[model samples]
Target: MITQQRKLVTELPGPISKSLAQRRVAAVSSAVSGGSDIYVAGAEGAILLDVDGNQIIDFGSGIGVTSVGHSDPRVVAAVTEQAASFGHTCFMVNPYENYIELCEKIAEVTPGDFDKRSVLLNSGAEAVENAVKIARAYTGRQAVVVFDHAYHGRTNLTMAMTAKVSPYKDGFGPFAPEIYRVGMAYPYRWPTGPENCAEEAFADFVGQVHIQVGEQHVAAVVLEPIQGEGGFIVPAPGFLAKLVEWCHANGVVFIADEVQSGFCRTGAWFAVEHEGIVPDLITTAKALGGGLPIAAVTGRAEIMNAPVPGGLGGTFGGNPLSCAAALAAIETMEAEDLPGKARRIGEVLSARLTALATQFPQIGEVRGRGAMMAIEIIVPDGSKAPDAALTKAVVAACIRRGVAMLSCGSFGNVIRMLPPLVSDISLIEDAMDVLAEAFAEVLG
Candidate 1:
């Protein structure tokens, strides 16, 4: 509970954590890996307390799942009250009021003023899978289009939809069929340069959809407005709007996969709102449940109702406890205006990272919006080659210094920061200070 500031009572992964790591190796699955060796005993705000009494600054936010902060009191109270009353009745069999209320809240918060309906699920991938199903059912098509360097989820269909291959999709295939991949307007690594990225990428996407995958046969075009697992790649201006326009013309559902970019993480209700575009369907999860497992697919009622009464849902979909936590999280976000908070966090991240980039040529580019930001690491050579080794070293240095950071990207050369929105200016500055020291130690 004492997490207002950072403290290091012991070295990283001291005795307690080491023992736990050994126990974990014996008990837990090998597939479940962690960013650090330190075992969390407790967490609050932006600080994670290790079992050895080391208080580390949290910059990852459990991979963007705790935007409201770890163990938020309001969320805890709501979940506790709901759990004491009753944990699960299986909403599909015996519907609950909290589930319905959560759906209403999601409809109000997500984009599009049109009549919308929602189906709650357990994770981002489930939400996306359901969205694809709905789109296909409604459009009477089978092709689902995704962009390069995109990371949807770990499910079979989502793995097929994802672009990265190493850990996510290496030996997992043969994946689902009829999934089309297109080039994203990645501004930093555009072959022709940032100036021509939007138009060229758009043209290429149109050509691919037409020539390779017929636009008429496509069910949905799904993309993250600001690519999350793709090194926080913010596409060139107007890229997403053009895609939305094309989807409209072709009758393809434009699905915004806001699992990581939604819930005030991008300084807006959803990242797509930054461009004033309304997606026909939106898939959201991560922070939506306030550290609980809950995801939802919200969209126009006509599209959402494409599936029959028993066609969509899981045994645990929209569990009462997760619904309570989601409702409380939404209330906290609205009451505190967390979107404004996220904008301020973005300003801090931009200022700190921009200054760091000026100091280190290895910092290829600093990009992202609001609490979700990242720095792509590259070799100092003019070719701008990704330096995955150097990125790993930098992240290791940060962890050794009691700051938890994350590495992501197709090539593993990007350091992303997803600090909790509730972290105050002082805590954020402290985390950035540690980051600055880490960069100086690694890049200098």
Candidate 2:
């Protein structure tokens, strides 16, 4: 189903999508961000057929969800089979085997063998909120420490933990209190270079957290192994493990928000594995259900058991259909050796971007792991001036040329990539060629 595409046919929004947007505006909530033009109709592998009949390469993977690609045969079959058999029974009320089976699988794959446990949820944000809840329940502490440039979720508690303020927390205030914000080990934007040593940077950031929040009152310290939406920025080497050690020493649980970087997106099941560090809790979503809404909060058995029986249950929290899809997705990942494939994809993608950087002056920084990647666009040489206009132009150019691109960052200046791990290698190379042309059109 990896068909080739070559034409835009109409404007990026096209007349059809614009009309749909008109109707959508009348019905949908305005609070939701994004455009109607980019709406998708069908997807398979790396290509998306939009409402306008335009076939676009899906570089964002629905914000990093469809790892095996949209509508994979196995996932579709599993969903259909489960939906036909039984849809809902509510885990807290009736329970089921799939949930238990999925939990066992997650425990097997997740880092840290010390009797890990997991609980399924509806979305990444919910898992994150639950992780903090478990940490608080276990440690009997009130304060939780978060880092700058970290994005956990949009839920009330998660919003408080999130770093950016503009859209995610603009009007919503009085976020859950006792939450403290600390600096991160972001190397690209750091005053020091990659050689500055992330171990040293993390040590400094941890010291600042204890000085400000006081370790005695802290429940947990949450962070992203690779900051997603905060620019696909990866923390420097030794940073993650060192921070976990610091938290453990201070009796603070360490939470890894791997919702966007988990699975095979980082060439590993979890980005934390890159440093051989096991998180006290790991929140995962996006690619877990193959496209369906599903998430999980996995952690050490003791911490997972901290919460009371009735404390964690959702009406739709482990929807059977999603569980089935997740089962299939997990199977597909292993069968396809996606972790190895993901690492190869990163090698190719990073190489292409590195070459593009040499030819174009606009691509400021190329950073990320596996298929999850990005390029920070700046105004000029060595300047941090966010080039939102330039970034928008690049995306527009790509859409016009039948290629879909997505921009993210607090300033909307970073062009992030999240192509499906199952995408055709040649198609990725083709997209790279188109991107090179788009860069010329926008930056020249």
Candidate 3:
């Protein structure tokens, strides 16, 4: 059932999927959203098999969750072995060795040479909220600063920190207060052009912090090194490093929300590594457990310990099975040099996407590092206006042609590609070909 080749024997969203969709409409809440109509029966490597037996190539990686790949053998084996031994027994009530070992691994792999500590949680939102809690506790500051086009998580506090409003925040208010958003060094959309983005953006961020929210009251300045949902917006070079220096000077805790760009997705263990900057706190999730739900806030020992003994914990924070899966995932990432693998994947994406951009003027930009990349679709008249409709059309064509795709960006014009790091060379080529063909069909 876990076939690597993409084979479409029937129409996409074929009979079985159509029936399942009808059932889902009847049984599931409209709030629980879905992007594609094809219901997956099984997935392996870069291929997803739908209930209708159509094989589709997956480029989204479940929005960057399945980095190692769906049903990775190492992850499956570890999870199974751990479940057979014991599945639950809260880490708070009864400590587990696996949980401690996982924390150790977190400290070892994360950036920063100083002693670090971690607290595990069930989701990225929880880890982000906990990071805020830790920073607030440590600095005794009430104000939190986040950048524009940054997405922390979906929790109430994180929703407040998030920059976008339509789907993630639309009816969900009154959000947590005392959270402030400032400018980001988005090169592609810089008003004064990308040349001045680094200096201008950083100055604007600092000025806003001092004018709108005093630096002394700021607990933490959180950001995604490479903005994910807002678009694969890699900041102008030296921007983050400069920001980090300012945060250090102002005694503001710098938190890197690596929820989407961590764990070898960005050609490095963490995206911040590219700029040679070390964050005071780093939140990680998505790829940590290979395919399981797990997240952690790893940071300086002094800051992470600021929270009281009982302040941080959940019923299933670090479940035994998730811990086992994480250990195996980390081992697999290391043994296979997934960071190196991500670089090679980036090369393939860069060559193909750049070629597509040259052909299709609608592709305003192609950005992102490693397996995490995106094409910003725009109008062809050189106005640089976001062409969200064209983006949707291209993505729909990909889905119909037996390839899974996803789109993101505050304006909804970025088609993001987050293929599994374990994807074979042939699979990457095939997926890119399908995407290019989709663009030609839609744009031409």
Candidate 4:
């Protein structure tokens, strides 16, 4: 097994990785962007072994996909065992026990005491699309409401629901209709102030739905408890609960897109649990599959069953191998108490990042829950203007120094950290040290 440590044997994207990059430029579409040119050979725990014989610390967790750690033994073993028996046998055509078992596990963990049902899918986008479909079917409404800075997916309907435009929805015009965008209770950038963000934003959101979309015409109100690609933006306290309450009262299906905040990434099974809100439908992916391609929309039985037979499902929705991996991942989460581990990681991140902010005025704010944390970069000119260039420089500096980092936000000025739950505290501390060095080098 590769040692779990950061060791740069050669420059990042060394000979082999450079060669792979050249080949990729020739074969792969330029449309598929990546964080770095460093090609990965293998990964274990919180370390990634690059093709150039470098072990880089992983703080992104494959964009929050491998929460149980890369190549977790349990997930690998389960997938291997299941693949040996059967790989595909469309659940809709020929049902399987593992599929049912995984759904049962999802229900037990997902926040809700009411009986729930689930429909497995292949990706987060697919799950979001299906969630909207189910909500429309149940409510008999045409409009779907989403918040600003929210990222749902890349599908036509999802792209319409998503807020970003540059890469996700740019030029992909003529999107699905009946999608309405509303303001989010972003405490960091709220116009009035952070203190009034929750109540004011909630009021604006409700008023917009009432005037623009009309309450009765809305099918669902979809949101990420902690916005993902939208900079890990954690909505103000009471904002989520108010929205859920309004959704229930107005007969709008509340869909929580927990793709990035689900599993143990947020110190809870789902970020909504932090707000004590039970969504009518919850779309999950990313970490749920333990690196496999699987997503699900689990929610109330009445709403889920509204869709008639043959209304939901895809050819590879619940592949036996993916189901096996999910079951093992859930088992690992429970047995290891990864939620508590995430809380500890959050403590370390909050402390280190908060302290760093004191040294670098460019770091405007530090916020997040559990391992899902971020720092918004701003110009030190006292105006708090976004500093995308500085953000990019800091991330590049960290990558060159062997700590893999990722940045995201509406203005691309937020540095987000999502280290694996199994990462050693010492390893995380080392990564933070590298981050501080990168910030100092860039700012100085």
Residue pairs with backbone overlap in model 2:
none
- Could you tell me every candidate's TM-score relative to the true structure? 0.99, 0.97, 0.99, 0.99
- The best candidate by lDDT is 4
lDDT of 2 by residue, 32-59 (tens): 8853266677878778887887778888
Model 2 Cα RMSD, Å? 1.5
Give the Å error, residue 420, model 4: 0.6
Distance from true location, Cα of 373 in model 4, Å: 0.4
What is the C-alpha lDDT profile of model 1 across 88-189, one tens digit per residue?
999988888999999999999998899999999999999999999999999999999999999999999999999999889988899999999999999999
lDDT agreement of model 1 with the native: 0.92
Query: Local error of candidate 1 at 197, Å?
Result: 0.7
Candidate 1 vs candidate 2: the TM-score winner is 1
Q: Which pairs, if any, clash in model 4?
A: none
Residue 151 error for model 2, in Å? 0.8
lDDT of 3 by residue, 290-405 (tens): 88999999999999999988999999999999999999999989998989999999999999999988888889998999999999988878689998999999999999999899
Model 3 worst lDDT run, 10 consecutive residues = 1-10
Runs of candidate 2 exceeding 4 Å displacement: 1-7
